[model samples]
Target: MNHLEYVTCGTCSRLITIDVDAAGIIRNLSFLGGCSGNLKGICALAIGKPATEIKNTLKGITCGSKDTSCPDQLATALEQMGY
Candidate 1:
């Protein structure tokens, strides 16, 4: 299975690291330097989840009504893998 690591920008959530298996499924996820609630929710939502589902679910999620968000960063990471 493949692995990946990434960080999210904007909002109060500063960073996140996630490891996804070759099938684009999340095996693990961790949040660092971010707002507790948002980060916690992200981690929970990611674990054992497919990247495509996550990407679709989080698409266009604006952080506090802003332009970017942690979920978007996760989507970018998966898309970079050619999802």
Candidate 2:
């Protein structure tokens, strides 16, 4: 299992913390300083899912005119954590 914290860039969320199991499954996920409901939805969708799957699904997503969204940053975090 692995526990990692990532500071976000180009998103409303300031930070993201994730827990991954030995099998590369996301056991828990949380974000700080982002959209409450949206991040909650992201958490619900991410828990118990494969980190690679989530990373693939969320990568390159953008918000408004920004180049990166919270989801995109989360994907970056997952990748940095060796998902």
Candidate 3:
């Protein structure tokens, strides 16, 4: 299994740590240094979900009114995996 470490930025409400495996799949996720509810939401969404699926859901998502953010970057990273 491969692992990709990422940090979520912008109006993310909190910082997120994402771990993706070799098959472009999410192996585990942890929301660090952030709100409990928000982190729980993210963690719940990410766990057991495919990397591609997660990327697709978060792709092009802007933080607050911003056009780009770390979540978008995370999507890009997943896309780069070619899954």
Candidate 4:
């Protein structure tokens, strides 16, 4: 297992930290400086799911006027980890 810390751009969140197991399944997830309730919900749904799934589900998402959202940044983090 390895823990990854990804600095985000263009979102309210400043950082995202993730953990994935050998099978590429998400073991833990957290976001810093974003929507509290929404990030909590994301963490709840993401834990134990395949990283690939989450990456695909969130990759292209955009937030209102910005080019990327918290979810999209999470996807970027997963991709950087080679999901």
Please give the lDDT score for candidate 4: 0.96
lDDT of 1 by residue, 6-59 (tens): 656675655566677877788887766767786788878788889888888887
76: Cα error in model 1, Å = 1.5
- TM accuracy, model 3: 0.65
TM-score of each model, paired residue for residue: 0.79, 0.97, 0.65, 0.97
All predictions: root-mean-square deviation over Cα?
A: 1.8, 0.5, 3.0, 0.6
Any runs in candidate 3 off by more than 4 Å, and if so which?
8-15, 80-83
Please, what is the whole-model Cα lDDT of each candidate in the order they appear?
A: 0.73, 0.95, 0.66, 0.96
Give Cα distance to truth, residue 67, candidate 3, Å: 1.9
Error of 3 at 37 (Å): 1.7
Off by over 4 Å in 1: none
lDDT of 2 by residue, 1-83 (tens): 79998999988899999999999999989999999999999999999999999999999999999999999999999999987
Between candidates 2 and 3, the one scoring higher on lDDT is 2
lDDT of 3 at 72: 69
Model 1 CA lDDT for position 81: 59
Number of clashing residue pairs in every model? 0, 0, 1, 0
Model 3 / residue 3 / CA error / Å: 1.5
Q: Write the per-residue lDDT of candidate 3 for residues 1-83, one digit (tens) a residue.
A: 65555555564544445667766668777655645675577668777888878888889976667886555656765666564
